[model samples]
Target chain A: MTIQRRAAFGVAAALPFAGARGQAAQTIRIGVLNDQSGPYRDISGPSGVQCALQAVAEFGSRGFNVEVINADHQNRPDVGVNIARQWYDQGVDMIIDVPTSSVGLAVNNVAREKNKAYINTGSATSDLTGAQCSPNTIHWMYDTYMLAKSTGAAMVRAGGDTWFFITADYAFGHALERDTGNFVRGAGGRVLGSVRYPFPATTDFSSFLVQAQASRAKVIGFANAGADTINSIKQAAEFGVTRRGTKLAALLMFLPDVHSIGLETAQGLVLTESFYWDLNARTRAFTDRMRPRLRDVVPNMASAANYSATLHYLKAIADMGVAASKASGIDVINRMKAMPCDDDAFGAGTIRLDGRKLCPAYLFEVKAPAESRGRWDYYKLVQTTPAEEAFRPIGEGGCALVRS
Target chain B: MDLFGIPAPLLFGQVLLGLINGAFYALLSLGLAVIFGMLNVINFTHGAQFMMGAFVAWMLLEWLGIGYWGALLLAPLIVGATGIIMERLMIARLYKLDHLYGLLLTFGLGLIIEGLFRNEFGSSGLPYRIPVELQGAWDLDFMFMPVYRGWVVLVAFVMCLATWLVIEKTKIGSYLRAATENPALVQAFGINVPRMMTLTYGAGVALAAFAGVLAAPIYSVNPQMGSNLIIIVFAVVVIGGMGSILGSVLTGFGLGIIEGLTKVFYPEASSTVIFVVMALVLLARPAALLGRS
Candidate 1:
């Protein structure tokens, strides 16, 4: 009786692996791991999965059966690492669209170990392509370098020369503050001072704001994103720091952030994002396609990058044989890097040697309340940094892949 | 004059900022202390209820066009009624169980409520405009004090005082104190101790909701907002002498000031300062600063 019972349990355990083995070859599972309920949910969460699904539809999957699955990492590195390992081990070919930087770096390690593609769209840390760049990962969306150049450098050039930063105390915030400070000082602007507040908590930024104001900087650069960015901006207005002609530079503002801030408060704030739905006809067409899928949510750069990255990944799969692509993640990443990236969402762009996606970064000035048009129309384009200069120079990135 | 490398004016500004934050801590911990004193159960749902208060205020504005003034009154009442129902159906059953059971149930309930709100609104946090009457700033000698912030501190102090009075002075307050000490005796005396416990729970939840309404204008009215603040407030309650009314109020403000000063001296340790204090307080006095033996 014991032998029979043990045999039955053994068979039951092996059944799932057998089923997984049969489906692994013909299936392409893209796992969308992101901050589904944390601070980044608005910027990119459930909508990111929708963009991935939209990518599958637009690409048409060719011959393989494509499935998109998503899970919330809760913005923790351990949680993200576990999900990434589980997904990769269970036949997931790629994991895409993680917003939080710590989680992004953690999952980047997991993907390299498991030999699965990681097309990052949401994280802003430049370390993904610098010291921590993995052969399995592609840094797809806007990074700290692009944002600091577009918003930070642009503001400095426009005569907001002196800057103070209210930086979130985390990997993402530290990277942004560092990159922007470098650009600010590089552009002959003086760095007044900065306050690094605790992250994921410490919502009351009154003391930090007061400190920045007292620094008497020409511009207050907010080196944080999501709800932290929204709160600081809203509170800064309440403190009337903006009223005294100190320009507020939102170094990394997502579309949903401006949406949440409303026009009256968000007006006159300058920010940088790689994708805007209202930028051009192609972007508009892409938005129209995604509108029905996303359900009343405006598709921001994060969402657009998910769509662009997924489509390009699928296209690379179509170019290279499925067996070869599945056999090595590095090969697939190299193929993706080899191909010129063209999509309706981001237009024409190229994947650099350092695994960074090179695309034009737009400097957008938030329209004044009176100058606003309608809903979701928050930005008026100020200037555009071209695709070639939009990202960091490969030599300066300290990426081993690029250096060799 | 400068102390510890920070200028005096900035130090004064940080102190004032600390007081404003203390106002929130005082109000939140007062409710927590009251509930723990009467019910002997940890109120983990307080954070979710606070979040509900903010969401209700947003709903009243978006759905019914009610302004901030209207929401200040209605949000608490509505959330308090829900708390009463929650106490009756769920929390009341666990009165005879261990503290662990009460904690597990309420923590699970808090997660569910926060999840439901996140599902509906998403975690990006909705915007609530500052009230028109309290919009401008007062250029103080040290800093620019937003009128709304000052009003928040004033009203929070008054409300904390009022809550303290009702529980410490009145005949109803005496009955509440008596019921907590000897519920069976109080019930035998025709005091209806069970009803009082239920009402105390409701009132404590209402206090959290009131704080939420006050916070809606300043902070992000998102589901995670309460959870983020709740941990610190719990630390405040623990340091204040859990279940001690006056202790919770005083420690709430005191810790806020300490945390504020920490932000200036070493902002890296700002979030950790309260927890460190909590650990020290627990080690030195397990009963808490004002908690009875």
Candidate 2:
């Protein structure tokens, strides 16, 4: 049969099977699945949906009719898996931007098993590109290894040696600690000691701060995020640990954390990230476009990843003529693998079939009290971690996709 | 592997860390218990109130030049006064209703407070410096402790004990308890029950704010600060029965110590061990380790 004839036949046969009854199957159905209304709500809710819409608008003119569906996974692996399943079962071409790493990884498993494309933007586990790496998943943003390696090794080499970790006690924290420890040891620095505070630990980090102070480590690395990172740093200051010449290195701080801690406390802290608001002219332009959309929360790496990944997913669907051909999950995914994604976050990056999306990361120094002219005037670019050496060594990651 | 069969420094340090976490848990759970005792209401907003206290203190220092000492006394009073207004206006009506309504109302209040704070200050924490006097670390042979952290633990413990004493031993506490048990009788006996209820809520909320002030120096002051800790406190309250003041305090401190020890022995289970213990406790006796049946 001719390609055109076969494609027409496939659509005719798949029409009755599509989720939308009587509606034309010409529109590309993409699921912008994320944690919308739970713990991760503020991080990846309506803004994620808007990101998907922007992608659809940008990719629509290039021969794709896009439809986006947003859902709150509530940080539950089961919920995220179910959402992906439902979207796939209901004829969604791809699932994009599942944020919580556990949930994102779970969705990737479902997508791979079901033969659908899962464009991961929210998760930060290196496993998505390593042992747990799936042919069907793409970890588009920062991972623990990338974050730790960039900040830990570089900072230690720059004389911020002797480390104390104030870690959030969980899988993420463990991963961060392990990766950062590797970086520190590799950089000829000694890890003094560490303390693990429970997840959602109450307001007092006095004890952890005390432990960090007692270590007298030059750098107190906070391998935590959200309020936990904020609190630990705050308490460290209160105990005068920082003033006593102990510098802080927040391994995974978001812009929101900087804003919350205010300029005074957040100043002079060196950290690393894949993206920053005022990094370059391109980034500034991107943030300018995303500002009205994000409202208060500045476009962090996660949001940027979401925007870029969603755009790339739609472009892949259009390129393969998946919607018109009524292609199954694996067909759509294979097509996505063939396309190159060039976006504002990573400039120009290709999706590796093994799911490792390579990107450059930057080391940022929180501006000193004197350096800051005003509020939001927080970080100054110190150095950029070259993309090649920014992430975990492929062989060491244990990702099945990497060949020995 | 070093000196003793176990590393003495490691053991000592872990113990110190345990004591420190225990102090925070005791202070937070103690505040929760006080709120529950008199208001008969689980102030879901307690964590938010705590966050507010820290923010208020930070603001006092930043905007008004009110130092740590001034904020320590003034911040809680400001929060307490707000609580009084909240008690008189909204919480007073729900006294006769199911406790769940109070929880829901307080939860709504928490959302509002968190949203406002997030909008105003953003999510990053504002650092509150420790006073110069408490800046240094004290060396013990085994493990060095920061002077400020040691002070936090001591002060929180004292505060917890004082609150327990005031509620369990004082004349005002006696009248407060009577009003809680039999409002009509207490009113007939010339004690204004409404005023007592309002004051109780005010006091209960004040404790939460007090904990906040104590925490401000340790944790960066942020909007979502209370939300994160609040859930854990809820779990703490559930594990410790909200009924008895002493039970809550003991359970809070005890669980924190257990959690710290778990980190040393079995690192993986450290985060989840508390919940696991809570589950086991629930299975053995549903009223919690120290909860009243």
Candidate 3:
């Protein structure tokens, strides 16, 4: 019999082994750690945490054993690191849904050092699976290189020749601009001009828009997100920049952002995404099941990713028998890493030992008013970038774990 | 380092952009300072009031065909009127209590306002159109500055000065200051001190609303807008020592320009550099540059 089935039966029978180390415990303890309150709070928070709980129940029937503990890091690197370390100390085999990039990076290092599996479902930095890659840390969501390749290169090839950037003046924005610049150049496109707006600066994109207008770039790339993107796009409309035939490409966006910008401004804009709410049968099924429990708000990609990672972690722990030493975090994590995942979110995805999980990326275009779709029907699939082609090539990432 | 025979011009243009940002910081910090001074209370809700001003202006235009000119005139009045009601019902009860009570109350109010708006509009900002009159750029041989941006700096400066002049020079201002120092004595003088205090708060909030109206053209009007900007303003206020009215204004503009220069040079330290400067200033004077000892 599989260890998962044993753990399941042990938990159901109310045996002492369920809670005791090495004893047959039916329940598996999984940690859901992410920013609950901070700058990144709205991006992923209690909603994602709750999604893991829903996953625990869904996967529980398949000889699954589960318990979930949540913590809010407030976007502090140290806070996230501490939460992760303590969870491992308490025999947590896996941690899921870490959001903030800097914080997520910090947690990745600690997870590798401790040998506890870390599933980063929310962070956007490419360094995680590249130079800073770890055997235990898996960056499950989108990154700048993917965004650049999928949006910038694809758009240029499809006839967005001249390019200009209106970037948020910061590290993240700078990285995005650099990647997109390379993609534009590689596509034989002309680099027209660019402007850097101070972070959190009010929306006045007039000077920036005027600069882009003067450059006559066919596409004015906005290397910013959140309020910055909303303001730049809106002001671009006000200045008639879009009407002047300059398309705006938002490098990163979320469903909430689309709702705020509305159809008039967002229509015909092409962007890349790892997941969309209504993308496939699996995605629709997950959202439909989560809606009743979640009080009817559609499940976003972050929440879905959290559910998939948490369930897979539990299955792995049950597969590995509860020997006292085996109950130690590193031992359990190693066991999970050896398994293949087949779930609702990413059906048949694998969690590699080096922690670079694989998933397909989708290129989506914002729908126009004539589409006459309901709310949240904002995006129509343009193309699906296969999992292998969607990300930075493994050979080029230079990750130490790729060799081992 | 020179391009197009315009080294000085480039420096001058960057300086002008710095000054433009300074004007905004000055106006926002000035509003925070005024609200703190009159009520002996830190209004954490000031940012929400500012956001409310912009949203009110947008709703008026989008729903009622009020137009930009009309919103510029009416939005502040509408928001200030709401401020008066809030002050009477909620803030009035907190006087003679620890000042933190008012701060906490305002913070709660800020959350409620921001939450309600977030529920309706989400985190992204709704764009407001700049008036047609303010559309073009002014080419001055050195830099092409947007006309609306130039106007924002000009009007913000005038508004800050007018606020200082009214509070420091007028008869009503003297009564307000007197009440701040000794409300019991001022009330004994048959001045309706409570009413005066309430109006003082309303007016201070009105200034924030006015700044919001000006901001709607430049920034997206969003629920989180006020919360994001307010934290920095708090840091600005702390650095200014909230000492005197003029002190907050000057410190705000000075620090904004300093931040802008940081952007031109290092760029990475631009955001946290203000707080770093605040720490150094605190170490040197402990009471801020323009603050009282």
Candidate 4:
């Protein structure tokens, strides 16, 4: 070979090496921000980040690299927004598992402004895809609308026509109560009244329970989540509210809350969710893979949704190639909407144009102590709403993305 | 059936519920009053210690097969010992500084303790079953009352009264009172004021923990349990004035009943009723309801 040809070969080899180095430097960073040390910690704290990492592992990182980082939003919107802004400036492509509605909404706005993707699996507010819908945000898992509809409509159908709510005083609680009340009224039930308790502060629900009892409502719907939900249910049992012919409806409940309240007291309480660990073979397999990493706590719907959403988000990135980085969050989200999402956790689902992930929502009754077979075996599925009917219709949400 | 436009049964039921809440308020505030009146140091870790008490009960049951009755006797001791160690290692060092320093130091300690527990056990609560003997309710014709709840109120009242008598009527309490007035003189007169201070702090923590053990059956045994009650206890201390033990006890129960009545008449203000009363008390008397200027 001529000396000039040998030199050309050397330059060509070094050019590929330089390109690989640049690609390596652009590792896709996914941030998981949620309550890590507060009341919501058990619901979606460090376990949420673990689920994301598991997704990254299962996705194989493809030809590129992926990294998962997390922070404790401490259930504060300002704290969540600051962390999101910092992560976005640091080149984080997506943020996930924001549980609290207040914090989730704040982070959603930040994602929109920063043009970064946000996959929310923790929050329950339908407003995410409603008036506050963002092109950069995709709300996965369940929402208040689904929860109220499944639990409320089912309860009303089962002879609970009069309702009173002991609600947690917050945006999440108000949305839950409003949505559930609408469903109840729509099903020919009447809402007697509702009393709001200070969130994360009121430990004693005896007074609230007494008032609920006096309302003469057959169904006392608890429109709250986390420890507040557990406390209200336990106190109601102790007061024998259920024994005295009043049904306690938990509008929003997690597996951990059921575990905390125990099957004995929590039994017969109706709740709604998009995922349960022991649902089927696929969900069981997914839970089996993630259980060892979860420190014995079964993956709640939020954490399970984290795994599914992260897997799908990675798939979308893989489909978009290296240009995924240059593409705006809306572009990636639009691509995600264009693709069908099929995963072990949620089975077959789709991301609607309004950014609401459509999937089946299950109405579950807490199992009696005699009915539970093993650890974390708490839920008994009563009914399942199909994907098309599970969430609010895309056109009904009034999203600017859908309108346009 | 209507009493002033409200159902008579509802009125009575809420009052019973309020009395139960007041019992807890009185118990916790009395402990805070005792410690503040004696130590001149605000133990911010009182809530964490209370949480520790509940966890100790849970641990005893889970680890050693101890029941709730055994836990009722042992959890407070374990929690008291923890307080003594905390007092010796961290809180005692801040006694020479401003009272705010003591507050800040204990507050940091509280955060550490609470964080450690939260890390060990996630924030979701654990169930503590009521004893089989106390599982039923009392049908008083006027209203139904859970047997366990009624027991809690009676025991709490007895505990608060006993604490008051010991502090106001016993020889050691007089020594404690004297030490609070002039520690240097008490130290010079052959009494170990520092040691008394440590014991007093531990006892106060034990009192809070005792309340926690009592609470475990009613409230879920969780890391943030003490934190939820501590703020209300602080408000109770302010309204009752940290200077008077009896005043703290009475105000705790009084405001509890008032809060219950508020729930019946105006459900919206139940949570803030105590704080609102605190503000009014501060406006009328800056030192507190019974606090000395």
Candidate 5:
């Protein structure tokens, strides 16, 4: 096993520099915003732009011209809001694929304020569909609720009852832990304890791991994403926490993380996602087409969600005419929710009133090193969670539109 | 069952882990201290060089089939030679200028190097495994102490002692110190002062790379790995008294323990404990703990 982490992020073709401003309604500008240079970079980076462009390409230039642009949020809320405002002001009809839940929440507000559409594909916080959902926004892919249900509930059912969390002290981490812990408790499992470490720092997780191990919880849920998740998992083995028969649950692991953490280390890690590149022939065909544009990086669920969401958004635009779609971002979102959507990546799904996308979330276990397969063939599907059972019910989310 | 509501073994495990972390801090800060002391140049590129060491090791292992032992021996040499080139080509020109100039130049260089690596490797980072010889952990009841971490601490202490001995007790060490104090006097005494300074800078860079190599297995070999640890290492060097070699090593280990303890009690404050200590140190002794006023 070689450490050839071939970055799927193609040399950042920081293209479409502040695209031409004239004839605003004629062009449908889509801005793909997320952490392009920080820990979450590979999770969606320029590859998101590539995925968005795949939608534009498949949709073709018929009724309206679609343009995909991207920028780095640097994982900061302020930066994310600023870019969202700029894109909205400069005639970006919709913004998509923003990760970093804090940043995603920040941009969600800006999209609402500026009257532009936001389709969140990168962030994991279920609050986007829950208390904070906006009429102008749609929570495109997987959320914490689904992840918790698919993984935490499964672990509980499998007899790993007690839980402890090593959480990143942030909105995303907090929500993930909260959501997962709810499942563990609701399912008759008890949460022994949890440690909240400072985010974007705290590289050494040995102390936290020690604390978790001492709790002797049957399950140790990592309520963090990106590098924090990778670091915690890598060190978990080193400390022999996993060998002690304690189950490790990566609450928000992305597909890219499996390879980066190495299958040897990531082996047996159970995760939940709505989309996998090798799920079916259509997904494979989609990956094959999008691979060249992405410089051969495999499509993670979020990036693929960008394409799925974008295609659905474009189809809505075509169905309602570009003028009407451009008239109001909320109306566009409403049209999206009203219409059922289907694509090669996520298959068929419908956006709920609370903005949660309906799709079957799959439970997967990371393939061991000896599970001989090519690169990117990391997951083995364990169970399929149908749409209604996959995500939080629309009635539970206190979204004003949903309640009304 | 535990002291102060915490088990003795757990506390000891945390301390050991902290010390292991301190080994890295000592190795990294030791390099920064040497560079600032000898060359009077604030090497902001120190982190980039450290990252380069890890990357070079990964490259050697993946591409050249070099094992960890080979990387420990050769990664620093390769990264250090690049450091030599950097000093000769860019840093040598700013020796007489303001310190800010060197800092800015090195800072910019660090960004460029990090950017280049990020572009090529992407930010998620690659995994470099623990060498086979040191793969397993010793079941110490309280905590499973990984043999790799023990190895890291041992290697770091040896390297730090050897570096201190070379700089403080030897003839070349005296010559290097004299050149830092007064280059003109050293040059007049038939010693090539510029060559000595360049080599000193190279050695410091190598030390950083050494730490990077040591860290490769434990941390993911990513471009951002060095950047994350560098700021704290600088804080360690500052608290250790800029160029005070012994101070840097001592403070690095001390701060690591403190940080580790903070994680046990309040993880939210772990990253801040060092900065808090640095602030207190600055207020208490402007010249730092061990620096000569």
Candidate 6:
């Protein structure tokens, strides 16, 4: 027993020397934190972890070992913050795909304090880049501001001017309603009134739908997401609110939401997104690789963003060499900002001063049942907002990183 | 012209919607009261059974090509049978222990059922189309009332009434109530008290499943569907007195209408309106509205 103990101690003493000699073999740890079993699971759960693995595979690890770990934040801000702090302490270089905006902001603060990177793919609040912006955080995929700019402005331009909002009562929902309201007012549209429903609990939207119908708003904006968004739209159809000619504009929607609502009920609804699986050949290829891993469900914007942002993060690390790990989070983020982001899923894009991913936003109209050719063929692209104009301008964002 | 500073049409329309919500509350709360009354077990799996009812209905349509009418009949039987098996295998074992054990066991069962469904089908809700016959709406000049919603309220009222009649007037209900009062005496009277307990639990579960089928078209059919509605139903049960069948039925509908009215006037308090009422009722009479000492 004593000899065995000595041998174990001898092996442990040699491990450090071996690890020092093979420094290039260091593992790059990436943490994927988001809702794994809640309402947002289908949007960016295990599929998100798979997306990050695909990025590592596509990047070939660049002579360094890449490891990916994931945990379910369960949509709780405290759970998310605790996981993020523990991961940072355990040498996790970055965290990706946090969905809930409240959780996303909490994790962002932890990453900021720890000087680690946080690539936010699931959160929709523009506050991530606005009031809560951090050099260590990258606001990837879509945000409320871009969604409002694409869907809200486009709806007003199409003559549905008068508006009423059935908003989910939360940080993400309020931000979406506020941003969309701004666009409505900016487009010479009249603001009627709005109602805020309890988040996740209020399934029946009949009374709220009645209020919207009575107000006679040309567009009844559903400033909510996931199950809430689908429920509002379905209940609205049942109540005959949509049949009476009031358009239902979903400000924030994902591919999974469209699929769940089905094409028949969701037809003619206009929404804005940063990624669509059928957008182009490159997107199709990326989606093709991810579809089998995602159990037949197509990649939504959040899962797709996981692939794009991780690839770009790796590219930045590859450009910076071994010194990238020791450098502060800001230095690495600055390096990523300097580099042009070109991924198959999102195509060519760039990170702005406010850390918002600059990608062209597409306006998609849900196709009629007769127009759809196959499964997952939901969106028909209506218009493309340029990369520069799609997101909130850097100067306008209240990010401390941006000059006034 | 406005009524009390709000448009008259808006006020009436909201009241109508409130009545519809109340119908669901009544049906679910009635089921809870029935199960708790006989077995003295809270049957925390009520919500999961409700969710299963909708999923089973969807599966019936998807796999067996059964329509709404078929689902309305079949889902309750299937879910009720499952409830019988659960009671015999798991819940029956906890009868000798404290009542808290029964509650904990059923709560664990609810989690297992919800988790299994969520794993099989993702949390994103699947849409169930409104039946073809009940598709259109009635334009009452003040508001457009969907025919299907109207049918739901009418059917729920009739179901609650029928259930009340069965438990209060029938001979079998007399045996069941006698069993609740003294199981030993009911057994002495040649009644199979254990079997009666099993059937009573099954019947109560069937009631919840029936409501689930009715709700499939109105709400998105998802695993978490029953969970959200169950908490509100529990509050309704408490406010009405869990012991009184008619009391639960009344409280359920009353709170639903109050919640609907709150939405029109104070939208923010709509969700918590029932809880607020529950607290007020507790303060006024700790025994609940119709609860016995």
| Backbone atom clashes (below 3 Å) for every candidate | 0, 11, 7, 0, 0, 0
Stretches of candidate 5 off by over 4 Å are A1-23
Query: Candidate 4 vs candidate 5: which has greater DockQ?
Result: 5
lDDT of 4 by residue, B103-218 (tens): 88888888899999998888998888888889988776545689999999999999998998898899999999999898999999999998998999889999988988888888
lDDT of 3 by residue, A1-404 (tens): 11222243343334343456443344456667775543344455666877788878776554545566677776678888877776665556577888756778888888777776677888766777888887666677577788888999878988998899988876567778988898899889987877777675444455566557666689999998767777777667655677657788899877666666777767888887777778889888877888876664566667777877777766766576544323455565556567877777777776555556677778889899789378678889998787777777787777887777
Q: Give the alpha carbon lDDT tens digit for every residue of A4-37 in model 6.
A: 2234234333433555656623767788887877
Which should have the higher lDDT, number 2 or number 5? 5
For every candidate, C-alpha RMSD to the true structure in Å? 4.1, 6.5, 6.0, 6.7, 3.7, 4.6
Model 5 per-residue lDDT tens digits across residues A1-404: 11111211121122233345444457787878877778877888878878888889888877667766677778899888877887777667899999989999999999898888999998889999889999989998899999999999999998899999999999999999999999999999999999999998878898898899999899999999888889989999888898889999998888888878898899999998888999999999999999788775899988899999999999899889888877899999999999999999998888888888899989999998889388898999999998888988888878888768
lDDT of 1 by residue, B1-293 (tens): 99888789899899999999999999998888899888998998889988899899999999999999999999999999999999999999999899888888888999999999988888888889999999999988678999999999999999989988998999999999998888989989988888999999999999999999999998888888889888988888888887998999999889989999998888878999999999999999998899887
Q: Tens digit of lDDT per residue, candidate 2, span B146-244?
A: 788789888988998898889889999898778777889989999888888788788777888887887777676777778867776777887888757
> Which residue pairs overlap in candidate 6's backbone?
none
Per-residue CA lDDT of candidate 4, range A61-146, in tens? 47788867777778989888877887777667899999999999999999999888899999999999998999999999899999
Chain B TM-score in each of the candidates? 0.98, 0.94, 0.94, 0.97, 0.99, 0.98
Which 10 consecutive positions of candidate 3 chain B have the poorest summed lDDT? B1-10
Q: What are the runs in model 3 whose C-alpha is more than 4 Å off?
A: A1-24, A159-178, A188-220, A235-247, A314-344, A351-353, A370-372, B1-20, B52-170, B213-223, B234-266, B272-293
Global lDDT of each candidate: 0.89, 0.74, 0.75, 0.86, 0.89, 0.87
Q: What would the TM-score be for candidate 5 when compared with the true structure?
A: 0.96
Instruction: Report the number of the highest-DockQ candidate.
Output: 1
Which stretch of 10 consecutive residues in model 4 chain A shows the poorest summed lDDT? A1-10
Candidate 1 CAPRI category: high
Q: Flag the better candidate by lDDT, 4 or 6.
A: 6
Candidate 5 — which pairs collide? Answer: none
